[model samples]
Target: MATKPRMHLALDFSWTQVETDWRQPTSWVNRFYPDIGLFEDVARICERGLFDLIFFGDSTGIPNTWEGRIDAAVRRGVAWPRMDMSPWITAMSRVTSHVGFGLTYASTFMHPYYTARLLNALDHVTNGRIAFNVITSQRKADFQNYGYDELVEHGERYDRMEEFVDVCKKLWASVDPDAFVWDPVSGIVADPAKVRPINHVGRFFKVKGPLSVPPSPQGRPVLVQAGGSPRGVRASARFVDHVFGAGKGLALMAEQRVKLDEALRAEGRDPQQVGILWATKVIVAETEAEALRLKERLIADVPMEAVGAWLSHNTGFDMSTLPPRFSLRALNQRIVAANASPVGFVGLLAEQYGEDMEISRDEFFRHGLHAATGYASTKAGTPVQIADYLEEMFEATGSRGGFMLGHSQAGHRAVLQNITTMLVPALQRRGRMRTAYEGRTLRENLAAS
Candidate 1:
């Protein structure tokens, strides 16, 4: 008998609007504070709905990488100057009962020691309701901000991540769970026996062991990373518990999922352990037409120039440098990678686009691959429509789950309303997903049947 699938919602909220509009910081995202209004509403709603974790995505680099202008990046509201998501997530932890928070930051650029200490502190602050979305920083311009001559090549960047993640793991392990025990009778806040120095030496990093903070809830916050290149698969295979991706169709994404798992085991890691999650967007309404109308309005509201900037920064190529026809067969492999053997970098150009290699790269860009719009008809009509599509997605990919929702207006609130009121109940009727959280921490939720 087939066991039912478990669905977990991960939010990329806060600075969630990657829309290439909204020039001012005030316009970027309303109420950056997590303890206050919208975020609070979002938290309470998701908690009631029993979401596993809602991830807070923050990019160190601007969307201005393509055009070399911060102005366009700022106007579009694409990951601009932002508050550290960790502190805000701590605020959410104070309010919510279950639901963990996954905070995203770059693994490629930042020093691993700082990453370890910061994440460990968040783990303490959130009482273990935290996870890390390990990322190889995106912008070529970010390297310049940190005073580097150029962006590290793709393969080299993943190599750095391998070392960086190792260092973080060691740092997390350094402070034993039994290290801190306050007792006034004997007078010992922490045991000296528990302090283990890391003294780790690697090609990219060197850290003396033992993090200062002790374990709080989960042994170590769950490690999460998004799908990038094939080298990304190898990196994720070794470290990520959940891998996030976005695409236009479930079938296309399912194909990607298979490739990811194969890459995982090829790297000698158990592919089954790593969950392949599709990064997606689903705008729901009481009616299918209503949803379509709303989507059209949102797309129109987005400025073409802003979208152009997003495209440039993301693909890491100046649109002016290459038209639609130039085969992007080769990216700076130090950064971008080919999928499977002789596979076009599906992370950039899905294999579908490569059949006509002579097609303009610009033409290929318009195919809606970066965005996992999902569904052939572009409609998740009624509660049943959404549920049916979600189930099909799981069946197609053999994925434990698919990731939908992110930081935006009513990010969690909107999703929870849709899930609890419409989606979840619909799935429950069909015998997929869960009615409640399985555990108190993020990992527990991910593992819960």
Candidate 2:
């Protein structure tokens, strides 16, 4: 018999207004600092349900994907006008006793020494309630800050990432977990024998460390990886605690799982030790029809241009190059078939809704992010149906859970209310979510081997 599933329901707090009511714009601005009271509310809700974590997602560079300007992204409340996710995590820690904080930094952007320290500090502050998403972003402009005129080829970037992760891990392990005693009488703090420099030299970087930061709870904030490429799967299989993706459907997700399984086996890992979370959206109402109605309201405030730009960024191509007749095969051939299935889906969406998406660039900017690239779901009328759908989703994808919401910078409360009031109860009743946290610290709750 399948035991109840334990879900880690993290809110993407849209950080902006989600509705077209136009009465409240910029609701998302507050999540940057995450008003202490509101954050405390989220922590309370998640902890009440024993949710594994409540983390924030961030992009290192601007979301200026369309026509190379930030206006379209800003207008639609896509992702342009957001605040740094790091500071916000401290707020999350201050307010919550549990619910691990997922903060992100790209391997391609930040140096390992600095990146490692921030995570260690936060881990110390959170008492082990921290998770880090390692990313390689699509923004070419971010390269300017990294001293590059252009982004490295994806293959090279990931190859370098392998070294990056290795270095970070070595730095973490180099400092034994029990190295610090702070013995005042003996005038000893850390045993020099326990703390040694990790001499890391590779294709991308070389750092002699002794990571500058002291180790904290969960050893290192549990590592999480988000990318769907073949290389991404391989890299993550070796190192990450969680892998996040937009599972296209049951069949595709199953196929992807098989690939992930093989990767894990090759790396000599127990596949069960690595967790997967799919990007998902849900609408729940007192009744099923009511839920569908709620969804219709959501799509209206969308910016289609943002969706197009998202598709382009997925494949690192220009949206203008996407034609109505653009088939997956043709598009794949354009990139010499080095494309991921993510690109193929863009081809599918463009072929399916090109006419509706072909508005002025500004008009389309915020239209489609809500048009999920992953699972499309709705649950109306009663909690039973919601539980049934969640069960079905898990059965279909072989994922432990779903990344159930988005555009959080647009509205945090809507997501909080949904998971707390609707989703969590539904899953709990069905025996799919944890009834209470089984262990202490965020990692014990989420990363059980």
Candidate 3:
């Protein structure tokens, strides 16, 4: 059986417009801090779509890589004023039963014990309806915020993350699930004998004892990772339950799946164990022509400066500093050499234009600048047309993990509303999506497809 495909809402990217456009009447994010209204409504919408989970990919600091300045990022809301998503996950879980929540946390700077305790408590709070999107932080400002002089090299960070996750796992297992036996007759709460110290001494992290919190309903938070580099793929194969992917289209995603499966087999693990959910942007409407028109409108609204800022932030290169003659392929080479962060879709640009093909400055601007317009892997169609595209991708990639859609126009609410009310029902009618969740815990629900 083709594991009934799974779907999740990529909140971080989708919610980007909220801050800039929040004052607009259609904006979902009414305010910045304590986004109670925004989150609750999003949770209900995702739940109605029968989404397996709603996830946020977060960062810790204000990015300043663009033009060697933080002004653009801060002003444009390019991942600035970042809020800790942990609190919102708990709040969302309160209103929904089965839709899971995944929160990103960097393994680079955080102590293993703290990570273990925090997520364990959340797992309990959500009744195991939680996943941790483990990320290896590479942003220089993020490192500086944590009292580090510089960010570690990419490979070394993942190495440390491996040990970080190891220590956390041991701490989570420090207290046995069956150890807690509430016996009012003898006034005993837990079996002390069953609890033992992990005493994990690792290369990157050292933890002394058992976690104070008891075991969560799902034992441990599901591990979600998004690492595209070779070392990253290997690390994910060893530990991750879900791997987030980004590509330009279904063909590229299928290619990535092949690579991920190879990594899993190399690690002596079954390829089926890890789900590959490609990060995608989707636009849907009552008709295909209307969706195309919406895409065009969205493209026109995107500020090119925001694109440059985002690219600079991600690649650690000031777009303005580069020579005017620089080609997109050249930029990719520079990023690959720096190992600053995942090159992501930019790396795949070479596939479209042959390696030797030169994408001129204007050509590069035409494609790269509109990334914020939400067109990468973007499908524009009616409900059935969108459903058909999703089904085709599922069949092509053999994606047991399914898709993570980040609606670029999420602030409009209409896009999200159409998805839950129109696209989802279309999928269900075709038996491509679930009518209801099959499991109680997020882990179980995830295991379903």
Candidate 4:
């Protein structure tokens, strides 16, 4: 008999209950935002479930796009108060042996050498279980923090990103893996022949010389990128080992896979070797009713101001300036003109609801409520039911990649517990999930999948 098809699983703690869920009675984040123990517990649980990686998405600025002020975002805690999380990942690594960690950085603003060196060190600390998620920041708030007065042109941002990765890759390869030889007899630490200067001078950055660190396990960190637009897809194909896909719907997901495959082939890379981890939101319970009940809390008591703040920050267009009624096409054109992400929330909206369709402000907020809270895409059900949905999606989307399951209600510890203890066992019984970690490093385990 043919071996049963299996899928990889990752838990996304990027937002980490910063959504309205933090206000719920079941959430503990209100009392413990930076508590190391909180993340350590999560690490242990995920390891027990045999998760491949725990991902953290990041932004360096507070939301000030809504109504031209940061008060609303700060007051509601929407995408604000984010910690660096590198140290947190280090702390979690100490407790788990098999799981990997994915850390995000913005290529649009950060220097390539700094990022490359930092990830190399993290790979050493995690014993080779590290993945680098590089992004091109589109939010105005992020640009301001980087000393930019306005957003970079959409295509130019990707241009910079490509060059950024090129520089990083060159730096990573500067020092050969076998360079280190701690020969005490000769008082020699490394061979000069194996180390050389990269001397890279690109349009975005200039860096000189060999990285001042030993070669890390896996040689380099597994590279991950999330770019859903055509330009973004091309950039991802050029370098990314895997993709962080937006889970809009089955059809869109399949279409994205095909586009990525085409782009990969254009770059002379095989599509089969690279996977797309769809960003999925799920709420699992013993019964469907219980899961649905928890899902309802996502929209509970969330004011319009908070929704506006989130939408504006992500799309880089102030929702407060939206006309009483407008078409998605018009709004998207405006956002693109402003040099924001052309394929963010507005792009998703156009794909879902026709671009020419006009929507009233109130109706838009209703949709925004679901989008901002992640309720529109969240799947809630029992372990068996959720697994079935996942199985269908995994197969429909070419069965190459897997799901990066993000928590719908961030602070609901019980929800995460159910995923590891209940849902993972269900998938394991069906031979759809890994029963044991098969590789020492993250790249190897992803290859095993």
TM for every model, in the order presented, reads 0.85, 0.85, 0.93, 0.99
**Candidate 1 lDDT, 1-449, residue by residue in tens:** 78776666765564543452132233323444323555666677777766777777665666555556777767655556556666667777888878778888787678888888888788777767788888776566566667865566667777888889888887888777888889989898998888889899888887886777776578887998875556777778778888877544666677678888788777787766677656555656678886665444334444545555655555555444445455545433322431112222333353555533555554544442223112222343567777777777777887565565533223323434765567667777776767777676777778765
Clashes of each: 22, 32, 0, 1
Poorly placed runs, candidate 4 (over 4 Å): none
lDDT of 3 by residue, 11-38 (tens): 4343454333444455555553345767
| lDDT leader | 4
Q: Which candidate has the top score in TM-score?
A: 4
Candidates ranked, most accurate by TM-score first: 4, 3, 1, 2
Q: Model 2: per-residue lDDT, tens digit, 371-402? A: 43221333344457766766676776665645
Cα lDDT tens digits for candidate 4, 1-449: 77776889999889865868788888868667778888998889889989999999988899999998999999999897888888999999999999999999999999999999999999999999999999999889999998999999989999999999998899899999889899999999999999999988877787996899998998999999999999999999999999999998899999999999999999999999999999999999999999999999999999999999999998888999999999999988899889987686788888888999999999999999999888999999999999999999999999887989986844688898899988899999888899999999999999885
**What is the lDDT for 445 in model 1?**
77
Q: In candidate 4, what residue range of length 10 has the lowest lDDT sum?
A: 406-415
Where model 2 places Cα greater than 4 Å from the true spot, the runs are: 1-5, 14-40, 301-303, 309-315, 321-325, 332-381, 399-415
Candidate 2 to truth, TM: 0.85
- What is candidate 4's CA lDDT for residue 416? 89
lDDT of each: 0.63, 0.63, 0.75, 0.91
